[model samples]
Target chain A: MSNTADPVSYLDYQGRHKGILGWILSTDHKRIGILYMISMLSFFGVGVILGLLMRIELLMPGMTIVTPRVYNSLFTLHGMIMIFLFIIPGLPAVFGNFFLPLQIGAEDVAFPRLNLASWWIYMLGAAVALTSLFVGGGAPDTGWTFYVPYSVRSGTNVTLAVTGAFILGFSSILTGINFITTIHRLRAPGMSFTRMPLFVWTLYSTAWIQILATPVLAITLLLVIAERTLGLGLFDPAKGGDPILYQHLFWIYSHPAVYIMILPGMGVVSEIIPTFARKDIFGYKAIAISSLLIAFVGYLVWGHHMFTSGISDTARWIFSLLTFLVAIPSGIKIFNWVATLYKGSIDLRPPFLFTLTFIFLFSIGGLTGLVTGALATDVHVHDTYFVVGHFHYVMFGGTGMAFLAALLYWWPKMFGIMYNEKWIWRSWAFIFVGFNMLYFPMLIQGWMGHPRRYYDYVPRFHATHIVATVGSWVLVTGLLIFAITLFRSFKSRVPAPSNPWGGRTLEWTTTSPPPLLNFTQIPTVTRGPYEPAPTPTGGETS
Target chain B: MKEQQSLSYGSYVLVWLALVVLTSVTVTIAGMHLGALSIATAIFIALIKGSLVVYYFMNLKNEDVMFRVMLLVALVTLTVIMVFTFFDISFR
Candidate 1:
């Protein structure tokens, strides 16, 4: 169905309420997913501008633009905005809310009202964080980590930010609980766990992490609030509280929070690769189990982040060892994706191109993670640009590319219109190239002991800093083109085929921009998600 | 709901009695201050009480394997984290 198709889709489901109210008040998971997308992208735009400002300020190294104080607030806000607002909730809330039920052949999530409540809670949290910028002191300057002493002592609005994050954690937990219940109770009669799509599997694992791990963050942030207001001695050294305990609690959630950010992206890649490759996924069980394994091992590795904070040497060793082990499941997933591409009909579609880029970029991110995971190297690179580059590669590159891939992969299904292929490829090239150019030099400079979060740098680091700044310009342009081209497709509004990518999942069985209840009749999925397809001998044969 | 079973008031009383006995034993052990053994003993007793609540009071015994496994996984995760944190503090 087109946007103006005969059938009444979710876009018009809330006929009683018109415009924004209809969207905000509707309980349709699909509509809720769209609401999340719009709100998150708006926040993303703010984060992008903040990132660009930081890059501009860092261009010449010696107070080129903003002062050190402003730079501190900028980075802090950027981190808080990107991590809490965009990345962590990015895939699952937007795509997961939209597709999880459809993929499992359900009418909607088990709790549609609860699902809507999550979106509202998320917006409320995000608004609270952004509001911190205006009142109760300027935006938090303790950086997003909000390490104690300074966070407790700072005159800025650390309390509001931390409380915002606390509320957001609840939102995350609610979504997690809803997804868990939905997956367990709402799967169609014949759609067994193994028969579910990899996307659903990743969401399932991520939901567990969200439910269990997010509370630690909620409590930790509440402790920060307590420390800020009630003079709680929980994390303050002056009051006999160890600062490292803050680190321990923060990473306890934040580390698995990493998986919360990346796992869904991995899921998107899992879905995209098979569709583009025209082959059943290789080692499906391995990929599915690895998602769980990663979530399991993910909890133990939070200690690695505290190694340099003067945690015990034995703890360091244990954390380091566990960190290496966590990489195994991650490696298993990467290997399976690569193996799936082998001896197959690989289509170099925009979505596939983005998926391939995710593999390359995420590999760099994942490997560099090892460097940080190890004690010796991490000591040298702990607060350096190396850590910055590594995280961006993983977080931005990995999740960012997957987000784009998911956007492209599901765009037709989402809007019932096909975007221009030429612009899609062009945008992909710039993003891939510009992304590397932007972040890669940070690694080199960081390796050279160039510290991060510093407004002023020595003359020696200026060269690399300039290159990264220039790369930021290119990256921004590419991102602009990506957004514009996709948005422009609405003008022509060409109707999309139900199974545009020849996807085997239940989502593909429904109409593009599916109808009010998703399916006229719920599908009883007899076949596995990725059934085998003929190996096409056309362009880009793998 | 299909697995729901009728429980006599006497069984509830027995579970409550067992919990009380375990708590007093734990308290008496704590009063003795048997070095590291005191903490270990207290924790062990707490685990027994917790299991009894889960199995009987919570009716996990009659629940599906899936529910049991979910509970086990959560408990195991919590145990691992707590033990590891204590390991870091104690050993180093």
Candidate 2:
């Protein structure tokens, strides 16, 4: 053991704390991760309900159960909950917090207490956002992007929504600060930069984006709050302030915000791909470098979102090209993953299955993204279901699928419980089939001239709308089964063993449900992260 | 004993002073009528202040080579983002 003193004895004491207090007051990364998962899952369910209401309203088009006013409010709430509450904090807060230290062979994160504080801040932000529902004027209807002028003039609870977002931004920044410090200060003796796992590299890249981009969002929101409440005149057009500047500032953070959502998901895929392939990842440095490239290029492409919003023609053309250029690094990653799988021992386990599905779905998403990125095409498809389908393919199919894959891949290690493999396969099939069915119809409907964000639709769009609604039910059912499967697994009596997937990352070097101090002794890395090591004959020897 | 030695209180105070001074200068400059030069000046100062926070307050200056490289990579990426954004906006 690296720690010559009695490390196990110290950890044993930490494990014996009382139940609710143990979780509520604990600084342990594992407990904090569980807390994030629980909170995000609740948020995800709320967001999904809002989304279902949207699809139901759009099924036959013209004002089904609510007025346009209520319809606008529903979409606004859906977008805010999903983007801010679900995807922004999705994988990074859940998996990044739990696994970054473990993979780097650290005892715990550099600032354990600070980690707990970040979660409380996140919870507080969620509370503030939910409280807006009960406010006198109802919630904000300016959509989650909260563009100014309209947001400034809206009658809904803009103050409450903006404040909640501002608070969440702080929680994000704190997590970024903590991750950066831990990675810098706490790596094991021999874990060099080149020797670090791809997951850590992705987290490092993500931390940079989080720190740099989130502040822009905070300041932009503050400007909006001031304009609304204090008459700051920053985004008010009549007052000689350029409303376009508000769009620029909003997308400055919001665009990189996509990378914030996907980078950690990319980290999840990186960890999953190598273990199941049973080979060193192909072009490791290329993959690592491309991750940073994606994060960097992601910021420049925000202007593409505003092409139809009356941005200048020259600006539109520039954003168009930059948008295409940003796709290169993402393409590089896809190519490398495919090459990694070629002529290799491939496992058809649930995690690997999800990774494969992510590749296919994300490719379609990326191509559709290109269509939207093109100035000529975006004008036609802008604000249509085409854009909606494209994002859902990327965010929901790409990152959401990867999030589930990572959870299952690490569940054995995190909770020390083994789920049934049959149930895992069953749920993956339902989700994969159901998801495509749900989203695929949107592309056609959008192409057929179905405008998005409209409470009512023309009779011509009804056929595709019915199909889309049916697919959504299937998707929801699949998700329900997936949730139940996980719940049943968590309550099972059988204990899981570490290194269940024969993974080579340092996280597998410890016991399942690792101690509060993740490592008893800091590990000394001697090989590259994905180097082929002999498989353990039995399970992990902790 | 080792943990105590790692905590550098003096360095933290020094870094905070430097950051405060830099921020004040930036804000003062921003208030001036530099016309087109204002945005550039503000960003440059913010960059410097942000660097000081990373290097000293965070102790990244004394950390491992990998951390230094990571920070440098991030800085370069930040520069690229700003330059590219300017390219698009100015061309319009």
Candidate 3:
């Protein structure tokens, strides 16, 4: 962006083909990252619309718009799209791919061709997932967890859907392997493990979870498919299998999958807080190590999901304790972030503001998570709307907020464009209010003993459902405006600075839209990632 | 990486004593009938002993910090899972 007449960035560079084909076939990490961004936003839009329809159907209760069977399919597809398609692969596939190599001062990932393959595999997986909706018995009606017995008996296309999830897991695993190798082997000279950016640290930790745990998910899904098609007895009680074991394996990966959904967002906020707060991070070692600890400790707590399934009291209480342990690392991150913001030259910019929202909402999600983790409380709210609200607050409020922050923080750098600040603020107001308005009601109604995934709720639950549906309208309006602002930025003459946010990371060293090989010359990082440059604007600073 | 430290025979004996004490603490906690805390405490003690064996006897202490950290992560996760499953089967 510093160049008056734009230099050749990854955007302008061409390879074997022209235009879209060039982009698809390109091995460039940045191009693949852009492809992921475009694809994820498309899926997110569909997921949101599905969610909106579900909210509307719930607004008045008693078959307002959809049949009970149709409602079941809607929620199932919504969860599958949002989780497998958007959030799980969200940050790492998009921002991580784009920024990881850049921050570590590598030209591209360690496996560039493999990086391209991961995206291709992702598309194939997505195609398989989407195909299930149209073919066979229409969409799957078993809620996304695909709880067995029910999953085994459902006439809808559970097999195709589970197979799609299994393929998506392969894509996730390959991406994890690519990121791990790139981080370990490609850090620039003097950029020791301690010197890499916090985002890189989070990616490193997340990649391990992806590779280590995702295979369990693949195996679990495959078993579901095998049961549906081959009549396997691994999960069928009559054939001598316990259905409880299925929940164990699913959550074993899926709970850590929750951390995978969250950790990168933590990483994004870590970058945003230091840059906007205008101070080095507080407790860098703690934040860095906690990322790993969350990934590690996350595996111990999956059994809390199975308390009502008769998995024995011993497994129940032990899981409850380990679930509480997760709060420690999560709390460490929250405290360290707050300390970073305290008494610093704070700038309430777009990214940092998004981060503030994340902290508030995710804290609610975390504390309520404690309520959900306790054996006493969990038994009451296991399938209730309170559980639904807690999940949304964590996944959508926590991960979704951080995803917005990452978009705002990197939009300028990624494409050499900056969004209108005034519009961004207007959108943020609606989004922050609407997100809480929609999800908070679910918590209250859920506590009133309202169950989730039901076509008709008792009349007592109608008020909160209406409130949530209206909130969805407001939230969608905000998102539309936010999208418009970014679209409008492409034409604005406002030049993006090479280092727009005055970020200390290596990505700030090059042109705003970085060249084919990220840096003109690879940067040698001497100080810790957040350390300010010596003598203002020397090497590694614009 | 720093120079790897080798322990003297006295240090090894101290480690062995600590492991023995941790094992007894587990037995004592179980004897106290601390209910859920008993399982948690026993697992905690088991983790400590397992860490000692891995860190000292297996020479994980001399390797890279990431390796030791990784091993501890793996050991802690697997031990809890294995023990938790054991309790589930035993109680049934």
Candidate 4:
């Protein structure tokens, strides 16, 4: 069956509800995934603007545009919005929700209604997060980490802000449950675990992390709320509670949450690299198992963040070793990608270019992470701009780049339309250059003794800060251009071909945008996800 | 697909009642000023209630072996995290 042969696509399907309600009320997984994408991008734009405003304020260091308090609030809101709304749910919620069923040869997630409920819960959480800004005294002034004493003493809407986080945790946990159950129960006949795609493997690992680690964040955020309203003093020092314990609880989840953010990005890279390389992925079992290993090891390594926070030396050293150990699996995946590309017909399309950059940038992010992971070295640079630089390199560079790659790679399939390649290339160049200029200086400035979350830096940091600010401008311009390309695709009358990129996964088997039932006839899989390429002699070569 | 197993309504009610009573016990121990015992006792009661729900309300008893193993894995992972936290606390 041609996956796109049906005239009424999910996008155009006329359900019982009319227009807007038809979308909002529909329990279709694809519809929910699209809802998540539209709303998250709108919020991402808001987050990016907040970041730009912060960069502008840091342009000259001394009260450039906004006051110090406004700067603090800006970074706080920026962190909350980006982490909660965008990054944590980054690929899994958007792509996983949209394509998981199609890739697995199922109609929808195990619990389709629960899938829709998750979107509603996410929106409610977003509403509650934004409400914290307008409702109480003011926006949360304490940083997004919400360290104990300051979080407890801050007069701003810390409780409401964290309550929003608490609610968002529910949505995360629900999605995790749905994904795990879906994977376990719904694979098509003859499609065993090994036959699943790498993206599904990463999503499976991410789902487990979501289930396990998120409860800690939920409980931690709730404790913050309890401390604020009920005077529980669970993390307050003067109130007989230990603040270090709070850091422990917070990082316990936040660290694994990083994997939740990046693992799917890794999964996306795993998919794109093979498709563009036009060959079987190198080390399929290794990459799949590595995803789970990252999730597992990532959980125990949170103590690296607590190195300078007065944790015991034994705990600190063990954490440092585990931190280094976790790097092995990440390195494994990168090597596998490179090995897959070796001697293959490499297509340097927009998506492949973004994936190539993801490897480069994420490698930087991962290496510098080792610097901070070392106990002795971490003592010198904990909470410094080095930490900030390291974070962005992986986060914005790694996951962020992967997100762009995934969008470009899948947009043809998702919306059944293609973007202007010229703009896509231009935007990619600007983003790559501007991203380095933006965050790399922070690494140097951090090394030179500039602390993060500070409104103003000393005159020594003035030059690097200016470079970063200008870089932010370039980055935003690139993003805006990229956004325009996507919007322009809506006006194109030509529909994208069913298999735009000659993808090997089941998602590519159907039309660009598959119909209501992803496969009218269920597929029976007999081989692995990626097939070995054919040699000129007509022999199957691995 | 799992074969539908008939779960008795009375069994579900008993499990629900057990949960409500255990919640009251958790509250009672909290008010009893048991200090360290309060949290420990509360957690013990909570586990019992969770197990009840898992076996009864969730119908985990009749689900596939893979489902039980996955549940076991989640619990083992949680236990590892908790043990690590206590490891830090005990050492420090």
lDDT of 2 at B44: 86
lDDT of 4 by residue, A232-312 (tens): 877766778988999999999999999999999999999999988989899999999999999999888999989888888
Q: What would the per-residue lDDT of candidate 3 be over residues A114-140, giving only the tens digit for each residue? A: 999999988888899989999989899
Off by over 4 Å in 2: A1-17, A534-542, B1-92
Off by over 4 Å in 4: A1-5, A532-542, B1-62
Q: Give the local distance difference test score of model 4.
A: 0.88
Question: If the candidates were sorted by their lDDT against the true structure, best first, what order would they fall in?
Answer: 1, 3, 4, 2
Candidate 2 lDDT over A1-542, as tens digits, reads 12224244222445546767778677888778879999999999999988888778877767777788888899999999988988998888888888988999987789999999999999999899888878968988888888878898888898898899999999999999999888888999888888888888888888888998898899889899899888978766677787888888889899999999988888889888888887789889998999889988887788899998777778788889989987888888888887888887887788888888888898899899989999999999998999989999999988998898888889887876777777878888778887887798889878877888877788888888888887787788888888888889867735766577878889887777676677767778888888865554222322
Task: State which candidate, 1 or 2, has the greater TM-score.
Answer: 1
Would you list the C-alpha lDDT of every candidate in the order shown? 0.89, 0.83, 0.89, 0.88
Which fraction of the native contacts appears in each prediction?
Answer: 0.36, 0.32, 0.50, 0.54
Backbone collision count in every prediction?
A: 0, 2, 0, 3
Off by over 4 Å in 3: A4-7, A538-542, B1-83
**Considering summed lDDT, which 10 consecutive residues are worst modelled in model 3 chain B?**
B73-82
What DockQ does each candidate score versus the true complex, computed on alpha carbons? 0.56, 0.31, 0.32, 0.54
> Any idea what lDDT model 1 has?
0.89
iRMSD (1 decimal) for each model = 1.2, 2.4, 2.0, 1.1
For candidate 2, give the lDDT of residue A134. 81
